[model samples]
Target: MLSTTVYKQLPVVSTTTCYQFVRLSSTLAAPQNTPLSHIPKPSKEDHHQDATFVEPKKSPFDVSTRIYTQQGIDGNDDARYLTKPTYPHPVFPTEECESVTVTHREPRTFGDKLSYNGIHIVRKLFDFVTGYADPSPANPKQYVGTRYEMTEGKWMTRCIFLESVAGVPGSVAGFIRHLHSLRMLKRDRAWIETLHDEAYNERMHLLTFIKIGKPSWFTRSIIYMGQGVFTNVFFFLYLLNPRYCHRFVGYLEEEAVRTYTHLLEELKEPGKLPNFQKMKIPTVAAQYWPELHEESSFRDLILRIRADEAKHREVNHTFANLKQKSDRNPFALKVEGLEEPQPNHGLKVMTPTGWERKDMQL
Candidate 1:
């Protein structure tokens, strides 16, 4: 029995030695037949070379070759070829990656005509208000050159005010949709929930800017007044013409995209503003967005916000299209074909299980 056990253990030990010998031979570039005792140990240079060996690029479809490659072995977790040791970078969609084409649906019915007219008038009103010139005292001359510039502080203040107004439409739309569903005894499983989600998302954006901008009491008061008035007007507009209301929100979002894009450009210009880089991302913004934690630059935050606005623009526009179709034929069913917006670009604001009221309260 003792001899039998020793014989069994000898084979296991021999197998382990053979594995090591093979690895060592590969590392040392030694002949396979070289005696184990005579095999030379690898030098530091040899180890370095082995560590940094670059595999030839193979065709992506060459699965047979790829199966033996480091990328294939690691699958999606492959990091051996990375120049720097770091987590995989998340690729946030830029303006270029997203569709820029705005959908324009011509009026095909009486309801469509009414909705279209309402949208047209409201759009004009929005433009008149937004386009009003309030020249900066510091850059009074900037207003003359087909270009106007505001300091970063001023721009952030503007964002705070705009976000406050921007959040109003989604909330109003959501509340009305909920009420409409309740009154009709039909569940709008699609639009109602989506509108609420949009409202929450826009509110979070408002809160994020509030923390970052830290507006004065006067600014806060202005936001309060604006929200109250805008909320009332939008609520009535939605009740009268839901399709038009959706289109109006879509237009607002398009303007928001342009505003954020402009802000990003300003932030990128060297010496455009002294404190652009100095400002750290707000904690709320960071918590909501994990990518911000890795790269908490203002530019990255702005880009993320812009991406959200772009999605909102698409959603509201699509909603308008659907509403138009519904209005034309009340019995018709509309399907939401738009892709679900990406999850705040992988940011977690509310807990996975439920939203915290305190975290969300404006």
Candidate 2:
């Protein structure tokens, strides 16, 4: 049994050694049978030409390629571009852009004259009120509110008054054009006349109240400043352009005088101002008028009312003639005290009388 076992073990030992020898034989044959180029190749040192890697080509539409920086061109400066378009994206280039000259033409129409004169008067009136005093001695013209209030109210009244009266004469040039669109008075010369009549009515109503001593000091102040400025501007305009200004001032005075006369007739009868006895003087102004202590009478106020209107009427009438004279001369109508008042162009007050025809010596 031992002998048979030993013979079988010999075949097993030989089979294990043969398996190991086959593995060794294959390892030795593997490298020897490979091609030369297939063997491991050595890594060479880097060359400068090899180190450079080509960068990708850039596109024409890149942000840096399309963007540009620009500066502004000033009016006084010479043309930045010699032949650039006059307008941006213009169809054609501009020639003589630097040498081009602009010539101003004089105003030709009546409307233009009216606008210029009206604006000039408005601006001058504004300037006059700049340092003017309110009627009240306590409140000097230091406050801008006083000037603005005076300017606004006077501007409205005078604009209406001038447009209404001046428009009557075709001399005003643009008066017809401006009045053409007003629907209330049929957009005719009548509307301006109505404005004049209304202004006169307002003056009458106010004078009546002042005579009755019913309006407050504050209300009186507003009305007084407004009227005073209106008068000043009216006179100033008359002084500026007499032929046209006379129509407005003369009309205003006539309307105001007529209204005043009518009011006087109405008050002479007993029925007007029913509460004359009951109404009291404003506490402030009554400090000046002692009669308010015993209660006010409407009859007593009438004379004072008429007197004020007459005073303005006289002044306006005198100024109207002055304007007429100035128109003839086309220079300042120098009044005695107001002489040397600087003329704004020819619009200034030069003469003592007013506008006189140039042919007729002032």
Candidate 3:
């Protein structure tokens, strides 16, 4: 049994690992056999009556309210402590984030065309269902207040849904490769770790946005269903052709870059997205992106996120070009004193399409 002092020191909402939660649950569980109203009822007097009360949000989607990790937990349990990130996010300089552009790689090979068209189809279907239509760079008038335009809620909905799905590919890919390595009793050439990192980074993006904007229950349900379907589909396809899967994800990242870049352009119009303009970046966001601070606005946060998408685009596209099972992950390890430019985790040197196999030392 834990002492009173130890119980008092426990956090209200822990960002700890799963086994800790399991252990805590076991400690608190009712004894196995004695039942039939054996436990005593609570006294009229309430312990910790002075705890802060948080009103639950009634609206489906509202940016006016922000969700902190322990908002409601403070009333039920008062101890809340911050947790360090499992995977530290890469530092993105302001200039490097700004350098991110919406670029595309032409689909030349048969596999490339198949991946591009398949992704394009899925995107259009999703966009229509979510009521999101990008404001064309050419059509200036369609930026706001139209049937074709996106509102704060719609944009948040898209972001949450997009990220929920985006995280799946990397995890699925990494799992298959990891199993493959174990079965063959050979090294995976350092691909599994990079893929898992991509998944974690995408999840951070989702969590950061959740603090800034609430999604509707319908949207949440959609995310749940979407993730289930996409996970299984990606899992099976990866087993069949990992290269094609990587190529498909590469094209998907191209769309992600385009999506964020469009959002950045909308931020330029004064008074257009007032909520975004006045909003301070969430603590989770600033915590993940160390370069951000109290003064960072939503636009600044988007810039960092866009830069991440740019990197993923580069990484996945490059993965598609390499010999899947044999080639080492070039981005994971770099050669020193090499005269030629190389692929990197950061934006220092990047290619919109991918690094061709011939360009790499392999």
Candidate 4:
């Protein structure tokens, strides 16, 4: 048994020594240094280029002259490049400045004046009923009424009411136009279509505000009653004098534009309203106007809505003027120097799963 163990140990030791010897011999045979010809050497063009050779084309600005240092630091050229170009601040118009230049000036027409007066009376009556109290009296800033007074809550409430009323004129006008078309076979199709589209668009605005404001049940009840009364009244008014109806809608939209502009300004001011930053845009608004989806804050959403109101104002005023000029000529109903309203390219009224559809059947 001892002899067999010694023999086994001798074979194991010899096998280990033989493996080590083979590895050592292989390492020694491998070349330590590569051949001079095989070794990579720097090319003449890379290290010894001609001193007088100039680039075929150079940048307009000298690269060496630019000092790329941290921004806003002394001796940093970045400040010069990074600074925004100074622009003259816009001189906005005030109530006192009657002669001030305005982008959308009030229409100079007898019908427009009459309509404006009527709207002013209605507004005064509404204010009385609603108890017109300035919310921000301590920091009073005036635009339409008082800018500082237009808190987020007040603005939202106003939008709720405004949208409810805005739908009235368009719906009334569209229905009247449709009836007239049916009565007279030779109907002005363009005007009818325009009225219907406007009504639908205004209703969309109402829907957007509903989502954002989430008004109280009391407010919703008030809107329902007010809308019912106003719709009938406007329908009769449109039947009596379509021109005047158009003019009235135009003026109403003007007020809307002014009101939204005031609200936008108030929102921009820091620390103006409580929980202002916490306000978010509604999903419905993002769907209707996808252009606002990138920065879908309350401010951006308001701006887009304001633009729609302005467009409506312009269209209604143009329609009023056209009605005055041509009693029944749709061909003559062009807004001078104004392009046709662009279609809502970003409108995706359908839900992702197609489970729901927007009430935009114009």
User: After superposition, which runs of candidate 3 have C-alpha atoms over 4 Å from their true positions?
Assistant: 1-79
**By summed lDDT, which 10 consecutive residues of candidate 1 come out lowest?**
63-72
TM-score of each: 0.55, 0.26, 0.78, 0.57
Candidate 2, residues 186-235, lDDT tens digits: the string is 33322233234324433333322322222223333544565566555655
Candidate 3: clashing pairs of residues: none
lDDT by residue (273-331, candidate 4, tens digit) is 53444455544554566354424567666666666676566667655655332344232
Superposed Cα RMSD, model 3: 14.4
lDDT of 4: 0.56
Clashes of each: 0, 25, 0, 1
Off by over 4 Å in 2: 1-243, 277-280, 283-296, 323-362
Q: Against the true structure, candidate 3 has what lDDT?
A: 0.79
**The best candidate in terms of TM-score:** 3
Give the alpha carbon lDDT tens digit for every residue of 1-362 in model 1. Answer: 99999999999999999999989887777456656747766778655434332232243332111111222212322234433212222345444323332234455567556655765665465434333234454754455444234554456666776777777877788788778778888766456656666676676677666554445555666667777887888888788878667766766776677677666756776777545554555555666654566237667777777766766766665556553323222112332453422223232211121121222211
Give the distance in Å from residue 138's predicted Cα in candidate 1 to where it truly belongs.
22
Quick one: best lDDT, which candidate? Answer: 3
What pairs collide in candidate 4? 141-147
lDDT of prediction 2:
0.34
The local distance difference test score of each candidate is 0.56, 0.34, 0.79, 0.56
Candidate 2 residue 150 C-alpha distance from true site, Å: 30
In TM-score terms, candidate 2 sits at 0.26
